[model samples]
Target: MTAAGLPMEIRAEGLPTRVRIHEVGARDGLQNEQTVVPTEVKAEFIHRLADAGLPTVEATSFVHPKWVPQLADAERLFPLLGDLDPHRLPVLVPNERGLDRALALGARRIAVFASATESFAKANLNRTVDEALAMFAPVVARAKDAKVHVRGYLSMCFGDPWEGPVPLAQTVRVCRELLELGCDELSLGDTIGVATPGHVQHLLASLNEAGVPSSRLGVHFHDTYGQALANTLAALQHGVTTVDASAGGLGGCPYAKSATGNLATEDLVWMLHGLGIETGVDLDRLVATSVWMAEALGRPSPSRTLRALSHKE
Candidate 1:
Protein backbone atom coordinates (compact mmCIF):
# COMPACT_ATOMS: atom_id res chain seq x y z
CA MET A 1 0.00 0.00 0.00
CA THR A 2 1.16 3.53 -0.74
CA ALA A 3 2.14 5.60 2.30
CA ALA A 4 -0.30 8.31 1.26
CA GLY A 5 -3.20 5.86 1.34
CA LEU A 6 -2.34 3.56 4.22
CA PRO A 7 -3.58 4.27 7.75
CA MET A 8 -1.86 3.00 10.88
CA GLU A 9 -3.77 -0.13 11.84
CA ILE A 10 -4.92 -0.63 15.41
CA ARG A 11 -7.36 -3.48 15.89
CA ALA A 12 -10.45 -2.73 17.87
CA GLU A 13 -11.81 -5.39 20.23
CA GLY A 14 -15.29 -6.83 19.65
CA LEU A 15 -15.51 -5.55 16.06
CA PRO A 16 -15.86 -7.66 12.97
CA THR A 17 -12.53 -8.50 11.34
CA ARG A 18 -13.95 -8.04 7.86
CA VAL A 19 -16.56 -5.67 6.42
CA ARG A 20 -18.44 -5.74 3.13
CA ILE A 21 -18.81 -2.34 1.53
CA HIS A 22 -22.02 -2.02 -0.49
CA GLU A 23 -20.90 0.64 -2.99
CA VAL A 24 -23.67 2.99 -4.21
CA GLY A 25 -21.72 5.56 -6.26
CA ALA A 26 -22.96 4.46 -9.66
CA ARG A 27 -26.61 4.48 -8.67
CA ASP A 28 -27.33 6.50 -5.55
CA GLY A 29 -24.51 8.97 -6.09
CA LEU A 30 -25.43 10.04 -9.58
CA GLN A 31 -29.22 9.73 -9.28
CA ASN A 32 -29.76 13.30 -8.14
CA GLU A 33 -27.71 14.96 -10.86
CA GLN A 34 -29.50 17.65 -12.80
CA THR A 35 -27.47 16.80 -15.89
CA VAL A 36 -27.46 13.24 -17.14
CA VAL A 37 -24.17 11.34 -16.98
CA PRO A 38 -23.54 9.45 -20.21
CA THR A 39 -24.34 5.75 -20.16
CA GLU A 40 -20.81 4.71 -21.14
CA VAL A 41 -19.23 6.89 -18.43
CA LYS A 42 -21.55 5.39 -15.85
CA ALA A 43 -20.53 1.90 -16.98
CA GLU A 44 -16.81 2.72 -16.69
CA PHE A 45 -17.41 4.17 -13.22
CA ILE A 46 -18.97 0.88 -12.10
CA HIS A 47 -16.10 -1.06 -13.63
CA ARG A 48 -13.55 1.06 -11.76
CA LEU A 49 -15.40 0.61 -8.48
CA ALA A 50 -15.41 -3.15 -8.99
CA ASP A 51 -11.71 -3.11 -9.88
CA ALA A 52 -11.06 -1.24 -6.64
CA GLY A 53 -12.67 -4.25 -4.87
CA LEU A 54 -16.03 -2.95 -3.80
CA PRO A 55 -17.87 -6.19 -2.99
CA THR A 56 -21.28 -4.98 -4.15
CA VAL A 57 -21.80 -2.02 -6.47
CA GLU A 58 -25.36 -0.81 -6.94
CA ALA A 59 -25.46 -0.16 -10.70
CA THR A 60 -28.59 1.85 -11.35
CA SER A 61 -32.24 2.33 -10.52
CA PHE A 62 -35.11 1.22 -12.75
CA VAL A 63 -37.51 4.00 -11.82
CA HIS A 64 -39.50 5.91 -14.42
CA PRO A 65 -37.37 8.42 -16.30
CA LYS A 66 -39.59 11.34 -15.39
CA TRP A 67 -38.78 10.93 -11.71
CA VAL A 68 -35.00 10.38 -11.91
CA PRO A 69 -33.92 11.36 -15.37
CA GLN A 70 -30.24 10.87 -14.62
CA LEU A 71 -30.71 7.13 -14.18
CA ALA A 72 -33.18 6.76 -17.05
CA ASP A 73 -30.55 4.93 -19.03
CA ALA A 74 -30.59 1.93 -16.70
CA GLU A 75 -31.60 -0.36 -19.51
CA ARG A 76 -28.70 0.78 -21.65
CA LEU A 77 -26.18 0.63 -18.82
CA PHE A 78 -26.92 -2.80 -17.24
CA PRO A 79 -25.97 -4.60 -20.45
CA LEU A 80 -22.53 -3.02 -20.46
CA LEU A 81 -21.81 -4.59 -17.07
CA GLY A 82 -22.02 -8.20 -18.36
CA ASP A 83 -18.32 -8.79 -17.66
CA LEU A 84 -18.85 -8.16 -13.94
CA ASP A 85 -20.41 -10.70 -11.58
CA PRO A 86 -24.18 -10.36 -11.52
CA HIS A 87 -24.29 -10.98 -7.77
CA ARG A 88 -22.05 -8.00 -7.14
CA LEU A 89 -24.17 -5.65 -9.22
CA PRO A 90 -27.44 -4.86 -7.46
CA VAL A 91 -29.98 -2.55 -9.09
CA LEU A 92 -32.78 -0.54 -7.53
CA VAL A 93 -36.34 -1.47 -8.51
CA PRO A 94 -39.09 0.87 -7.37
CA ASN A 95 -41.96 -1.40 -8.45
CA GLU A 96 -42.89 -4.50 -10.45
CA ARG A 97 -42.17 -2.71 -13.69
CA GLY A 98 -38.70 -1.81 -12.47
CA LEU A 99 -38.22 -5.40 -11.30
CA ASP A 100 -39.21 -6.68 -14.71
CA ARG A 101 -36.71 -4.38 -16.36
CA ALA A 102 -33.93 -5.58 -14.05
CA LEU A 103 -34.76 -9.30 -14.32
CA ALA A 104 -34.98 -9.05 -18.07
CA LEU A 105 -31.49 -7.59 -18.00
CA GLY A 106 -30.31 -10.57 -15.88
CA ALA A 107 -29.79 -8.72 -12.61
CA ARG A 108 -29.14 -11.29 -9.88
CA ARG A 109 -29.57 -8.79 -7.04
CA ILE A 110 -32.13 -6.04 -6.51
CA ALA A 111 -33.29 -3.50 -3.89
CA VAL A 112 -36.41 -1.57 -2.92
CA PHE A 113 -36.51 1.86 -1.22
CA ALA A 114 -38.95 2.61 1.61
CA SER A 115 -39.38 5.44 4.09
CA ALA A 116 -39.80 5.28 7.88
CA THR A 117 -42.04 8.35 7.94
CA GLU A 118 -45.36 8.86 6.17
CA SER A 119 -44.33 12.31 5.01
CA PHE A 120 -41.26 10.98 3.20
CA ALA A 121 -43.28 8.05 1.86
CA LYS A 122 -45.78 10.49 0.42
CA ALA A 123 -43.10 12.78 -0.97
CA ASN A 124 -40.79 10.15 -2.45
CA LEU A 125 -43.26 7.44 -3.48
CA ASN A 126 -46.54 9.35 -3.72
CA ARG A 127 -48.10 6.86 -1.28
CA THR A 128 -48.76 6.42 2.41
CA VAL A 129 -46.36 4.25 4.45
CA ASP A 130 -48.70 1.25 4.31
CA GLU A 131 -49.58 2.04 0.75
CA ALA A 132 -45.92 1.93 -0.32
CA LEU A 133 -45.33 -1.37 1.47
CA ALA A 134 -48.44 -2.68 -0.28
CA MET A 135 -46.76 -1.66 -3.53
CA PHE A 136 -43.52 -3.47 -2.61
CA ALA A 137 -45.30 -6.68 -1.49
CA PRO A 138 -45.74 -8.28 -4.90
CA VAL A 139 -42.41 -6.88 -6.04
CA VAL A 140 -40.54 -8.62 -3.23
CA ALA A 141 -42.49 -11.88 -3.66
CA ARG A 142 -41.86 -12.06 -7.37
CA ALA A 143 -38.16 -11.29 -6.95
CA LYS A 144 -37.83 -14.06 -4.35
CA ASP A 145 -39.68 -16.47 -6.61
CA ALA A 146 -37.17 -15.62 -9.34
CA LYS A 147 -34.40 -16.54 -6.89
CA VAL A 148 -33.03 -13.01 -6.82
CA HIS A 149 -31.33 -11.49 -3.76
CA VAL A 150 -33.29 -8.51 -2.43
CA ARG A 151 -32.36 -5.54 -0.21
CA GLY A 152 -34.75 -3.09 1.39
CA TYR A 153 -33.73 0.52 2.10
CA LEU A 154 -35.54 2.20 5.01
CA SER A 155 -34.96 5.98 4.92
CA MET A 156 -35.43 8.37 7.84
CA CYS A 157 -34.31 5.80 10.35
CA PHE A 158 -33.27 8.70 12.58
CA GLY A 159 -35.01 11.94 11.59
CA ASP A 160 -37.04 13.60 8.84
CA PRO A 161 -37.58 17.08 7.38
CA TRP A 162 -41.37 17.31 7.42
CA GLU A 163 -41.52 15.11 10.49
CA GLY A 164 -39.33 15.49 13.57
CA PRO A 165 -37.11 12.76 15.02
CA VAL A 166 -38.73 9.43 14.15
CA PRO A 167 -39.68 7.16 17.00
CA LEU A 168 -37.66 3.98 17.43
CA ALA A 169 -40.82 1.89 17.35
CA GLN A 170 -41.93 3.44 14.06
CA THR A 171 -38.59 2.64 12.42
CA VAL A 172 -38.58 -0.84 13.96
CA ARG A 173 -42.13 -1.57 12.79
CA VAL A 174 -41.34 -0.63 9.18
CA CYS A 175 -38.09 -2.57 9.25
CA ARG A 176 -40.01 -5.65 10.42
CA GLU A 177 -42.52 -5.23 7.61
CA LEU A 178 -39.80 -4.99 4.96
CA LEU A 179 -38.00 -8.05 6.32
CA GLU A 180 -41.35 -9.86 6.48
CA LEU A 181 -41.94 -8.85 2.88
CA GLY A 182 -38.98 -11.11 1.98
CA CYS A 183 -36.24 -8.52 1.80
CA ASP A 184 -33.00 -10.45 2.23
CA GLU A 185 -31.37 -7.36 3.81
CA LEU A 186 -32.41 -3.97 5.14
CA SER A 187 -30.32 -0.75 5.06
CA LEU A 188 -31.19 1.70 7.83
CA GLY A 189 -30.84 5.25 6.45
CA ASP A 190 -30.15 8.38 8.46
CA THR A 191 -31.57 10.55 5.69
CA ILE A 192 -30.84 13.93 7.21
CA GLY A 193 -27.96 12.61 9.36
CA VAL A 194 -29.18 13.93 12.77
CA ALA A 195 -28.01 10.84 14.67
CA THR A 196 -25.28 10.77 17.34
CA PRO A 197 -23.43 7.72 18.63
CA GLY A 198 -25.90 7.22 21.53
CA HIS A 199 -28.90 7.47 19.20
CA VAL A 200 -27.27 5.04 16.79
CA GLN A 201 -26.52 2.48 19.52
CA HIS A 202 -30.04 2.86 20.90
CA LEU A 203 -31.64 2.31 17.49
CA LEU A 204 -29.53 -0.77 16.78
CA ALA A 205 -30.37 -2.13 20.22
CA SER A 206 -34.05 -1.41 19.69
CA LEU A 207 -33.99 -3.20 16.35
CA ASN A 208 -32.24 -6.16 17.95
CA GLU A 209 -34.94 -6.28 20.61
CA ALA A 210 -37.55 -6.25 17.86
CA GLY A 211 -35.92 -9.41 16.45
CA VAL A 212 -34.05 -7.69 13.61
CA PRO A 213 -30.53 -8.99 13.94
CA SER A 214 -27.58 -6.70 13.24
CA SER A 215 -26.32 -9.20 10.67
CA ARG A 216 -29.36 -8.54 8.48
CA LEU A 217 -29.01 -4.76 8.77
CA GLY A 218 -26.80 -2.27 6.91
CA VAL A 219 -26.13 1.39 7.72
CA HIS A 220 -26.71 4.14 5.08
CA PHE A 221 -25.87 7.52 6.52
CA HIS A 222 -25.72 10.94 4.87
CA ASP A 223 -23.02 13.44 5.92
CA THR A 224 -25.52 16.25 6.26
CA TYR A 225 -24.79 16.97 9.89
CA GLY A 226 -21.26 15.48 9.75
CA GLN A 227 -22.39 12.52 11.83
CA ALA A 228 -22.06 9.76 9.26
CA LEU A 229 -18.75 8.33 10.46
CA ALA A 230 -19.61 8.50 14.17
CA ASN A 231 -22.99 6.78 13.57
CA THR A 232 -21.25 4.14 11.46
CA LEU A 233 -18.83 3.42 14.30
CA ALA A 234 -21.77 2.95 16.65
CA ALA A 235 -23.32 0.46 14.21
CA LEU A 236 -20.02 -1.40 13.89
CA GLN A 237 -19.68 -1.74 17.65
CA HIS A 238 -23.15 -3.35 17.65
CA GLY A 239 -22.16 -6.04 15.07
CA VAL A 240 -23.56 -4.46 11.90
CA THR A 241 -21.08 -5.10 9.09
CA THR A 242 -22.63 -4.12 5.79
CA VAL A 243 -22.25 -0.41 5.06
CA ASP A 244 -23.61 1.63 2.13
CA ALA A 245 -21.36 4.40 0.79
CA SER A 246 -20.98 6.42 -2.39
CA ALA A 247 -17.67 7.24 -4.04
CA GLY A 248 -16.58 10.86 -3.54
CA GLY A 249 -19.59 11.50 -1.28
CA LEU A 250 -21.72 12.10 -4.36
CA GLY A 251 -25.38 11.62 -3.39
CA GLY A 252 -28.32 13.05 -1.50
CA CYS A 253 -32.08 12.56 -1.53
CA PRO A 254 -33.63 14.57 -4.34
CA TYR A 255 -36.83 14.90 -2.34
CA ALA A 256 -35.11 15.83 0.92
CA LYS A 257 -33.79 19.31 0.20
CA SER A 258 -31.94 19.57 3.50
CA ALA A 259 -30.14 16.27 3.03
CA THR A 260 -26.47 16.46 1.96
CA GLY A 261 -24.20 13.91 0.30
CA ASN A 262 -23.63 10.32 1.43
CA LEU A 263 -20.81 8.98 3.60
CA ALA A 264 -17.89 8.93 1.15
CA THR A 265 -16.45 5.48 0.56
CA GLU A 266 -12.88 6.80 0.75
CA ASP A 267 -13.57 8.43 4.13
CA LEU A 268 -15.24 5.29 5.47
CA VAL A 269 -12.37 3.13 4.22
CA TRP A 270 -9.86 5.31 6.03
CA MET A 271 -11.64 4.80 9.33
CA LEU A 272 -12.21 1.10 8.73
CA HIS A 273 -8.57 0.51 7.86
CA GLY A 274 -7.35 2.51 10.85
CA LEU A 275 -9.40 0.20 13.07
CA GLY A 276 -7.75 -2.87 11.38
CA ILE A 277 -10.94 -4.04 9.63
CA GLU A 278 -10.54 -5.78 6.28
CA THR A 279 -12.61 -4.46 3.38
CA GLY A 280 -10.41 -5.92 0.56
CA VAL A 281 -10.43 -2.50 -1.08
CA ASP A 282 -7.36 -0.78 -2.58
CA LEU A 283 -7.65 2.71 -1.15
CA ASP A 284 -5.16 4.16 -3.64
CA ARG A 285 -7.12 2.87 -6.65
CA LEU A 286 -10.42 3.90 -5.07
CA VAL A 287 -9.14 7.42 -4.52
CA ALA A 288 -7.93 7.58 -8.11
CA THR A 289 -11.34 6.43 -9.33
CA SER A 290 -13.13 9.06 -7.26
CA VAL A 291 -10.79 11.73 -8.56
CA TRP A 292 -11.51 10.71 -12.13
CA MET A 293 -15.21 10.83 -11.34
CA ALA A 294 -14.95 14.25 -9.72
CA GLU A 295 -13.41 15.54 -12.93
CA ALA A 296 -16.19 13.94 -14.94
CA LEU A 297 -18.73 15.71 -12.76
CA GLY A 298 -16.78 18.97 -13.20
CA ARG A 299 -16.43 19.52 -9.45
CA PRO A 300 -14.07 18.80 -6.57
CA SER A 301 -14.80 15.71 -4.48
CA PRO A 302 -16.43 16.30 -1.12
CA SER A 303 -14.47 13.49 0.56
CA ARG A 304 -11.80 14.74 2.96
CA THR A 305 -9.77 11.55 2.63
CA LEU A 306 -9.97 11.69 -1.15
CA ARG A 307 -8.84 15.29 -1.13
CA ALA A 308 -5.95 14.82 1.32
CA LEU A 309 -4.62 11.66 -0.31
CA SER A 310 -5.04 12.93 -3.85
CA HIS A 311 -3.16 16.05 -2.88
CA LYS A 312 -0.25 13.87 -1.78
CA GLU A 313 -0.43 12.09 -5.15
Candidate 2:
Protein backbone atom coordinates (compact mmCIF):
# COMPACT_ATOMS: atom_id res chain seq x y z
CA MET A 1 0.00 0.00 0.00
CA THR A 2 1.09 3.56 -0.73
CA ALA A 3 1.19 6.31 1.88
CA ALA A 4 -2.19 7.42 0.51
CA GLY A 5 -3.45 3.89 1.22
CA LEU A 6 -3.85 3.31 -2.51
CA PRO A 7 -2.99 -0.08 -3.99
CA MET A 8 0.55 -0.35 -5.27
CA GLU A 9 1.31 -1.04 -8.89
CA ILE A 10 3.50 -3.87 -10.12
CA ARG A 11 7.18 -3.34 -9.44
CA ALA A 12 9.03 -1.43 -12.13
CA GLU A 13 11.55 -3.73 -13.80
CA GLY A 14 14.25 -1.21 -14.80
CA LEU A 15 14.03 1.15 -11.86
CA PRO A 16 17.04 1.35 -9.54
CA THR A 17 16.55 -0.56 -6.31
CA ARG A 18 17.51 2.56 -4.34
CA VAL A 19 17.15 6.25 -5.23
CA ARG A 20 18.87 9.32 -3.83
CA ILE A 21 16.39 12.07 -3.00
CA HIS A 22 18.28 15.41 -2.93
CA GLU A 23 16.31 17.55 -0.51
CA VAL A 24 16.06 21.15 -1.83
CA GLY A 25 13.60 22.45 0.73
CA ALA A 26 16.07 24.80 2.37
CA ARG A 27 17.31 26.48 -0.80
CA ASP A 28 14.97 26.14 -3.79
CA GLY A 29 11.85 25.89 -1.61
CA LEU A 30 12.53 28.84 0.64
CA GLN A 31 14.01 31.23 -1.94
CA ASN A 32 10.62 31.96 -3.46
CA GLU A 33 8.84 32.32 -0.13
CA GLN A 34 7.69 35.89 0.47
CA THR A 35 8.48 35.70 4.13
CA VAL A 36 12.09 36.15 5.11
CA VAL A 37 12.58 33.01 7.16
CA PRO A 38 15.09 33.78 9.88
CA THR A 39 18.59 32.38 9.50
CA GLU A 40 17.98 30.28 12.61
CA VAL A 41 14.74 28.87 11.27
CA LYS A 42 16.38 27.95 7.98
CA ALA A 43 19.18 26.18 9.86
CA GLU A 44 16.67 24.26 11.97
CA PHE A 45 14.69 23.26 8.89
CA ILE A 46 17.79 21.84 7.18
CA HIS A 47 18.87 20.02 10.38
CA ARG A 48 15.41 18.47 10.64
CA LEU A 49 15.57 17.39 7.01
CA ALA A 50 18.93 15.76 7.67
CA ASP A 51 17.47 14.10 10.76
CA ALA A 52 14.75 12.61 8.53
CA GLY A 53 17.53 10.71 6.70
CA LEU A 54 17.98 13.01 3.71
CA PRO A 55 21.69 12.65 3.14
CA THR A 56 21.85 15.21 0.37
CA VAL A 57 20.27 18.50 1.38
CA GLU A 58 20.70 21.72 -0.63
CA ALA A 59 21.54 24.06 2.20
CA THR A 60 21.44 27.59 0.74
CA SER A 61 22.41 29.79 -2.18
CA PHE A 62 25.34 32.21 -2.23
CA VAL A 63 23.67 34.40 -4.83
CA HIS A 64 23.41 38.16 -4.49
CA PRO A 65 20.96 39.39 -1.88
CA LYS A 66 19.26 41.85 -4.25
CA TRP A 67 17.84 39.08 -6.42
CA VAL A 68 16.84 36.55 -3.74
CA PRO A 69 16.40 38.47 -0.55
CA GLN A 70 14.75 35.52 1.12
CA LEU A 71 18.04 33.65 1.29
CA ALA A 72 20.20 36.66 2.07
CA ASP A 73 21.38 35.05 5.23
CA ALA A 74 23.43 32.38 3.43
CA GLU A 75 26.64 33.71 4.96
CA ARG A 76 25.23 33.34 8.44
CA LEU A 77 23.40 30.09 7.83
CA PHE A 78 26.35 28.20 6.34
CA PRO A 79 28.31 28.32 9.59
CA LEU A 80 25.37 27.01 11.59
CA LEU A 81 25.55 23.80 9.52
CA GLY A 82 28.93 22.82 10.99
CA ASP A 83 27.53 19.64 12.48
CA LEU A 84 26.23 18.37 9.13
CA ASP A 85 28.47 16.32 6.88
CA PRO A 86 29.98 18.93 4.56
CA HIS A 87 29.91 16.46 1.67
CA ARG A 88 26.12 16.25 1.93
CA LEU A 89 25.36 19.98 2.00
CA PRO A 90 25.33 21.45 -1.49
CA VAL A 91 25.00 25.22 -1.80
CA LEU A 92 24.04 27.09 -4.96
CA VAL A 93 26.67 29.45 -6.38
CA PRO A 94 25.62 31.63 -9.31
CA ASN A 95 29.07 32.81 -10.40
CA GLU A 96 32.72 32.95 -9.40
CA ARG A 97 31.94 35.49 -6.71
CA GLY A 98 29.28 33.24 -5.24
CA LEU A 99 31.68 30.32 -5.47
CA ASP A 100 34.31 32.33 -3.63
CA ARG A 101 31.85 33.04 -0.84
CA ALA A 102 30.87 29.39 -0.62
CA LEU A 103 34.52 28.26 -0.53
CA ALA A 104 35.32 30.84 2.10
CA LEU A 105 32.47 29.52 4.20
CA GLY A 106 33.88 25.96 3.81
CA ALA A 107 31.22 24.62 1.46
CA ARG A 108 32.55 21.39 -0.03
CA ARG A 109 29.64 20.85 -2.41
CA ILE A 110 28.21 23.60 -4.64
CA ALA A 111 25.78 23.92 -7.53
CA VAL A 112 25.70 26.32 -10.47
CA PHE A 113 22.44 27.20 -12.29
CA ALA A 114 22.20 27.39 -16.08
CA SER A 115 19.32 27.28 -18.57
CA ALA A 116 18.30 25.40 -21.79
CA THR A 117 16.49 28.26 -23.53
CA GLU A 118 17.75 31.71 -24.45
CA SER A 119 14.78 33.48 -22.91
CA PHE A 120 15.07 31.75 -19.55
CA ALA A 121 18.82 32.18 -19.53
CA LYS A 122 18.40 35.88 -20.14
CA ALA A 123 15.61 36.19 -17.61
CA ASN A 124 17.19 34.21 -14.78
CA LEU A 125 20.87 34.97 -15.16
CA ASN A 126 20.74 38.17 -17.21
CA ARG A 127 22.74 36.40 -19.95
CA THR A 128 22.32 34.24 -23.02
CA VAL A 129 22.78 30.47 -22.79
CA ASP A 130 26.43 30.53 -23.84
CA GLU A 131 27.09 33.56 -21.70
CA ALA A 132 25.70 31.85 -18.61
CA LEU A 133 27.79 28.77 -19.33
CA ALA A 134 30.83 30.95 -19.74
CA MET A 135 30.22 32.46 -16.34
CA PHE A 136 29.89 29.02 -14.79
CA ALA A 137 32.97 27.60 -16.51
CA PRO A 138 35.50 29.30 -14.24
CA VAL A 139 33.30 28.84 -11.18
CA VAL A 140 33.16 25.12 -11.82
CA ALA A 141 36.89 24.96 -12.51
CA ARG A 142 37.76 26.76 -9.29
CA ALA A 143 35.44 24.57 -7.26
CA LYS A 144 37.03 21.51 -8.82
CA ASP A 145 40.51 22.80 -7.99
CA ALA A 146 39.36 23.28 -4.43
CA LYS A 147 38.30 19.62 -4.47
CA VAL A 148 34.65 20.55 -4.04
CA HIS A 149 31.86 18.63 -5.71
CA VAL A 150 30.02 20.77 -8.26
CA ARG A 151 26.47 20.20 -9.53
CA GLY A 152 25.10 21.94 -12.61
CA TYR A 153 21.40 22.75 -12.81
CA LEU A 154 20.02 23.01 -16.36
CA SER A 155 16.62 24.65 -16.06
CA MET A 156 13.76 24.62 -18.62
CA CYS A 157 14.73 21.22 -19.95
CA PHE A 158 11.25 20.45 -21.24
CA GLY A 159 9.62 23.84 -22.04
CA ASP A 160 10.22 27.47 -21.28
CA PRO A 161 7.56 29.87 -20.09
CA TRP A 162 8.56 32.43 -22.72
CA GLU A 163 9.55 29.98 -25.49
CA GLY A 164 7.48 26.84 -25.34
CA PRO A 165 8.79 23.29 -25.94
CA VAL A 166 12.56 23.67 -25.85
CA PRO A 167 14.45 21.47 -28.25
CA LEU A 168 15.91 18.31 -26.74
CA ALA A 169 19.16 18.85 -28.64
CA GLN A 170 19.60 22.34 -27.19
CA THR A 171 19.25 21.00 -23.64
CA VAL A 172 21.70 18.19 -24.39
CA ARG A 173 24.31 20.62 -25.69
CA VAL A 174 24.16 22.58 -22.44
CA CYS A 175 24.38 19.38 -20.43
CA ARG A 176 27.51 18.35 -22.29
CA GLU A 177 29.13 21.75 -21.79
CA LEU A 178 28.39 21.75 -18.05
CA LEU A 179 29.87 18.28 -17.77
CA GLU A 180 32.94 19.35 -19.70
CA LEU A 181 33.19 22.34 -17.40
CA GLY A 182 33.65 19.84 -14.53
CA CYS A 183 30.24 19.43 -12.94
CA ASP A 184 30.14 16.09 -11.11
CA GLU A 185 26.40 15.87 -11.79
CA LEU A 186 23.83 17.68 -13.93
CA SER A 187 20.32 18.28 -12.60
CA LEU A 188 17.75 18.69 -15.39
CA GLY A 189 15.00 20.96 -14.14
CA ASP A 190 11.49 21.30 -15.54
CA THR A 191 11.49 24.86 -14.25
CA ILE A 192 7.96 25.62 -15.40
CA GLY A 193 6.46 22.22 -14.61
CA VAL A 194 5.69 21.52 -18.27
CA ALA A 195 7.49 18.19 -18.62
CA THR A 196 5.44 15.03 -19.28
CA PRO A 197 6.77 11.48 -19.38
CA GLY A 198 7.40 11.60 -23.12
CA HIS A 199 9.33 14.83 -22.78
CA VAL A 200 11.41 13.37 -19.97
CA GLN A 201 12.28 10.30 -22.06
CA HIS A 202 13.14 12.37 -25.12
CA LEU A 203 15.34 14.68 -23.08
CA LEU A 204 17.17 11.78 -21.44
CA ALA A 205 17.63 10.03 -24.79
CA SER A 206 19.12 13.14 -26.33
CA LEU A 207 21.47 13.59 -23.40
CA ASN A 208 22.57 9.98 -23.74
CA GLU A 209 23.35 10.61 -27.37
CA ALA A 210 25.42 13.58 -26.32
CA GLY A 211 27.59 11.16 -24.29
CA VAL A 212 26.04 12.16 -20.98
CA PRO A 213 25.55 9.17 -18.75
CA SER A 214 22.38 8.68 -16.69
CA SER A 215 24.64 8.10 -13.70
CA ARG A 216 25.76 11.74 -13.82
CA LEU A 217 22.27 13.17 -14.12
CA GLY A 218 19.38 13.98 -11.77
CA VAL A 219 15.82 15.21 -12.41
CA HIS A 220 14.07 18.17 -10.79
CA PHE A 221 10.38 18.58 -11.56
CA HIS A 222 7.58 20.92 -10.57
CA ASP A 223 4.02 19.67 -9.97
CA THR A 224 1.99 22.40 -11.64
CA TYR A 225 0.32 20.05 -14.14
CA GLY A 226 0.48 17.08 -11.76
CA GLN A 227 3.10 15.28 -13.88
CA ALA A 228 6.09 15.54 -11.53
CA LEU A 229 5.86 11.98 -10.23
CA ALA A 230 5.07 10.53 -13.65
CA ASN A 231 8.00 12.37 -15.16
CA THR A 232 10.20 11.15 -12.30
CA LEU A 233 9.07 7.57 -12.97
CA ALA A 234 10.11 7.99 -16.57
CA ALA A 235 13.58 9.11 -15.48
CA LEU A 236 13.81 6.25 -13.01
CA GLN A 237 12.92 3.73 -15.69
CA HIS A 238 15.66 5.28 -17.81
CA GLY A 239 18.18 4.44 -15.02
CA VAL A 240 18.42 7.92 -13.47
CA THR A 241 18.61 7.48 -9.68
CA THR A 242 19.06 10.93 -8.17
CA VAL A 243 15.96 13.15 -7.81
CA ASP A 244 15.55 16.70 -6.51
CA ALA A 245 12.53 17.35 -4.31
CA SER A 246 11.38 20.09 -1.95
CA ALA A 247 9.72 19.44 1.38
CA GLY A 248 5.99 20.17 1.69
CA GLY A 249 5.89 21.38 -1.95
CA LEU A 250 7.33 24.68 -0.85
CA GLY A 251 8.85 26.29 -3.94
CA GLY A 252 8.11 28.20 -7.13
CA CYS A 253 10.17 30.06 -9.69
CA PRO A 254 10.36 33.68 -8.73
CA TYR A 255 11.11 34.67 -12.34
CA ALA A 256 8.85 32.30 -14.28
CA LYS A 257 5.17 32.92 -13.70
CA SER A 258 4.17 29.47 -14.95
CA ALA A 259 6.54 27.58 -12.65
CA THR A 260 5.12 26.01 -9.47
CA GLY A 261 6.54 24.39 -6.35
CA ASN A 262 8.76 21.35 -6.81
CA LEU A 263 7.58 17.75 -6.31
CA ALA A 264 6.98 17.44 -2.59
CA THR A 265 9.53 15.32 -0.73
CA GLU A 266 6.77 13.69 1.30
CA ASP A 267 4.80 12.81 -1.82
CA LEU A 268 7.90 11.47 -3.59
CA VAL A 269 8.93 9.42 -0.54
CA TRP A 270 5.44 7.94 -0.30
CA MET A 271 5.51 6.84 -3.93
CA LEU A 272 9.09 5.56 -3.78
CA HIS A 273 8.38 3.50 -0.66
CA GLY A 274 5.24 2.11 -2.28
CA LEU A 275 7.30 1.13 -5.31
CA GLY A 276 9.64 -0.79 -2.97
CA ILE A 277 12.50 1.55 -3.68
CA GLU A 278 14.68 2.59 -0.73
CA THR A 279 15.16 6.30 -0.02
CA GLY A 280 16.11 5.90 3.71
CA VAL A 281 13.67 8.67 4.63
CA ASP A 282 11.20 8.35 7.51
CA LEU A 283 7.81 9.33 6.07
CA ASP A 284 6.15 10.22 9.38
CA ARG A 285 9.08 12.33 10.58
CA LEU A 286 9.35 14.03 7.19
CA VAL A 287 5.64 14.93 7.24
CA ALA A 288 5.85 16.27 10.77
CA THR A 289 8.84 18.42 9.77
CA SER A 290 6.94 19.88 6.82
CA VAL A 291 3.89 20.51 8.98
CA TRP A 292 6.10 22.36 11.42
CA MET A 293 7.59 24.41 8.56
CA ALA A 294 4.10 25.13 7.20
CA GLU A 295 3.20 26.69 10.49
CA ALA A 296 6.29 28.89 10.26
CA LEU A 297 5.24 30.03 6.79
CA GLY A 298 1.71 30.60 8.09
CA ARG A 299 0.22 28.25 5.47
CA PRO A 300 -0.53 24.58 5.10
CA SER A 301 1.85 22.34 3.18
CA PRO A 302 0.74 21.56 -0.37
CA SER A 303 1.94 17.95 -0.09
CA ARG A 304 -0.91 15.43 -0.28
CA THR A 305 1.12 12.99 1.82
CA LEU A 306 1.58 15.58 4.53
CA ARG A 307 -2.06 16.53 4.44
CA ALA A 308 -3.37 12.96 4.49
CA LEU A 309 -0.93 11.83 7.15
CA SER A 310 -1.62 14.87 9.30
CA HIS A 311 -5.35 14.15 9.29
CA LYS A 312 -4.94 10.64 10.66
CA GLU A 313 -6.69 10.16 14.00
Each candidate's lDDT (Cα)?
A: 0.95, 0.92
In model 2, the runs with Cα more than 4 Å from the true position are 1-10
* Local accuracy of candidate 1 as per-residue lDDT tens digits, 1-313: 4674588999989899999999999998999887999999999999999999999999999999999999999989999999999999999999999999999999999999999999999999999999999999999999999999999999999999998999999999999999999999999999988888899999999999999999999999999889999999989999999999999999999999999999999999999999999999999899999999999999999999999999883
Best by lDDT: 1
RMSD of each: 0.8, 1.7
Backbone clash pairs for candidate 1 read none
Query: Per-residue lDDT of 55-133 in model 2, one digit per residue for the tens?
Result: 8999999999999999899999999999999999999999889998999989999999999999999899999999999
- Model 1 scores a TM of 0.99
**Alpha-carbon lDDT of model 1:** 0.95
